[model samples]
Structures are given as structure tokens and as C-alpha cells.
Target chain A: DARVTQTPRDKVTEMGQEVTMRCQPILGHNTVFWYRQTMKQGLELLAYFRNRAPLDDSGMPKDRFSAEMPDATLATLKIQPSEPRDSAVYFCASGLVSTGGSGELFFGEGSRLTVL
Target chain B: AQSVTQLDSHVSVSEGTPVLLRCNYSSSYSPSLFWYVQHPNKGLQLLLKYTSAATLVKGINGFEAEFKKSETSFHLTKPSAHMSDAAEYFCVVSADGGATNKLIFGTGTLLAVQP
Candidate 1:
């Protein structure tokens, strides 16, 4: 069975620390998405990739946040000097189609990180 | 721009009662609408989706949704509510016939089922 997998189900870090969250999307899925869930912002798209290439990342904070797919199986979100405002649940999701226009998203369990 | 709005912030119903979660969307182009449920500390699970295929769409766990293009609404419903149905529900929209795959999500509505 193929499922989107995420690491560090829970993480606690001090403010201004570097944080790296990783995800493994479902096998053979063409689209991968990164999202951040916060009480104030709800669920916000951080980045999106298709065929192992970044298609859009306008939702991310350019200076401090970066997302990359080093390989087909691994997608990483790096936050340098992560702020307390960045404390929230990060989710990695995959889909069958290239664009959400096709509809339906398969999501991972999510990686919860608390910035103290 | 595409966006979704969940009409209700919270709804509480007794078990075995009918369930309704309202959603409205705004998009420049025709959209593929969806309703997703998230259990505590879990990921969002697709409950149902509405494209051009049918006005009414049925999904897992007795959940269903209707796409009213004219009204720009896709509301989720269930025949009977269960305790396990308690969770956060999100209404999302994406351009079905457009170029991008990005999804715009609603703020979310919390549903509570009482035993």
C-alpha cells in the first residue's frame, strides 16, 4: 500500500533554530504539496511540486522558508532561524494528477512542530 | 482568485440525525469542489468531490455532496450522523478546467456528534 509518509511526528525547538521537515509522497503520485496549519492562518499552501520539479512556491516566505525535492521519493521543507510564529502543524500531501484541477488529495499524518 | 467558505463554524447534532455541512466557493473558472474531513491529529481525508460528472457525489462513510454551479455551492451531507463523524471539515476549490492544481481551502467547520 502506498501512503504519504512524514518524519518527526513531533518536534520541539527553540526560537531561531533551523528546522527541516521531510515527506515521502505516495508512490507514483505526480503532484506533491506542502501546507502549514495554524490557528491564525488555518491551512496555507507552502509549496507545490509536479514530476519532482517545483511548479509554484508563492505561498512560502521566500527569505526564511524553502522547499525542495532532492529525489523523487523525498521532499524537504527547510526553515532557517524558524520563528515562534512558525510553530504549527506541517502537512505533506500527494495526488494522482498534476494539478489540483483533477481534484482529490491524499495527505500524510502530518509533522507537528512546536517552536518554543 | 479561488476561495471557499464554510458557512458554519460549528454544528452539534445527536447521533442518528441527518448531517449537513455547508460550503460556498468563489472562482473565476469552473471549479472542482471537495469536502474533506480531518480527525484529531490526523490528515485531511477526502469525503467527496464534485466535478462536471454529476450534480450529486457520494463518498466513503455515507457522506455525500451536491454541486450547485449556479449557486456556487457544494455542501456535504450524511444520511445519519455517528459519533465517529466528529471532526473538522474543510471546503476546498480548484480550477477544474484551468492550468493550475492549487487548491483554495475554507477556514473550516467543526462538527460534533453527541451520543
Candidate 2:
């Protein structure tokens, strides 16, 4: 069965460390989304890419957070000088968006990040 | 701008009892709505979705939801609750009724199944 794959299921880093989370969307899916889950914020869409092109990143923190889709299979979310407040679970989801598609998303097990 | 409101933050039901989780949405136009369930330490799974099709949508795991345009509600329901059904349920709305549109999620409702 095809599924979205995420690296580093759990990560712990001290404040000011650079953190990177990677995702490999299911093959044949054309859209990838990054979402952050937190107790205070529920689920927030950090960014998304369609057809390997960045579609939106307005919800991401421009100073520290960056998302890129270098190719069709790989998507990355990076945080430079990560802070303690950034501790949360990040999820990557993939979907096949088409005229007759259901618009459903297949999510990867999230990457839990803790910045001390 | 589209948004969803989960009426309850928590709902507890005994096994074999009927379950109801209420949700209301606000949108300027016809919208696509969905229900997602997240188990502890797991990713969110799609339960069901409504895209202006039939008013009632049936989903996996014996779960279903009905979309009410006049009430602006899409409430999830299960005839009999099970212990395995304990999870966080979120109501989601597509900002623009498209796969590419951002999905606005409601604060989840934690469902507890008691024996």
C-alpha cells in the first residue's frame, strides 16, 4: 500500500538549533501539504505544493520557517534557530487533485519536534 | 474565508450507545466539508467528506455525517459507540471547495468510549 513517508518520527533539539523535516509523498499524488498541530493552535497549514511548485506559504513564519519542494517526490520543511515555542507535531499529507478526485488526503505519521 | 465550529470539546459515551458530534460551518458559497479522526500519537485519518453531493454521506468504520445547508451543519453520528472509537475528531472545511484550497479545521472533539 502506498503511503506518505516522513523522516525522524521524533526529534529533540536545544534552542537555536536548525531542524529539518522531510516528507516523501505517495507516488502519483500531485499535491503535498505541510501542517502543524499544537494544543493551542489545533492544525495550521504551514505550506503546500502542487505539481512540485509552491502554491502557498502564507501561514509559515518567514523569519525562521521555510518549505520547499525540490522535486515531485521530496518535500522539506526547515526551521533555522528553532525556538522552544516551535515545539509541536508536523504532519505531511498527499492528495491527488483532479477534476473527478475526492480531494482526500493521505497523511504520514507526524514528526514530533521538541526544542528545549 | 471558511471555518468550522465543533460544538463540543469532549463527548463521552458508553459502548453500544449512540454517538453524536456536532459541527457548524460558515462559508460564503457551497463548500466541501470533511471529518477526520486522529488516534493518539497517530496521523489524522479521513473519516468522510461532503462535496455538495447527497445530503448524507456514509464513511468507513460505521461512521456517517449529514450536511444541512439551511443549518450550516455537518454532524457526525454513529449508531453504536465502541471502545476502539475513542479518538479526537475534527471538522474541516475547504476554504474554496478545491483540493488546492487550504482546509480550515475546527478545534477537535475528544470522544471517549466508556465500558
TM values, all candidates: 0.94, 0.96
Identify the leading candidate in terms of lDDT: 2
Docking class of 2: medium
**Model 1 misplaced regions, further than 4 Å:** A98-101, B96-99
Cα lDDT tens digits, model 2, B4-107, are: 99999999999999999999999998888999999999999999999988999999999999999999999999999999999999999887677574678899
Determine the backbone clash count of candidate 1: 2
DockQ of each: 0.55, 0.57
True contacts kept of each: 0.47, 0.40
Tell how far residue B60 is off in model 1, in angstroms. Answer: 0.7
The prediction achieving the highest DockQ against the true structure is 2
Q: Model 1, B32: alpha-carbon shift in Å?
A: 0.6
Give interface RMSD for all predictions.
Answer: 2.8, 1.7
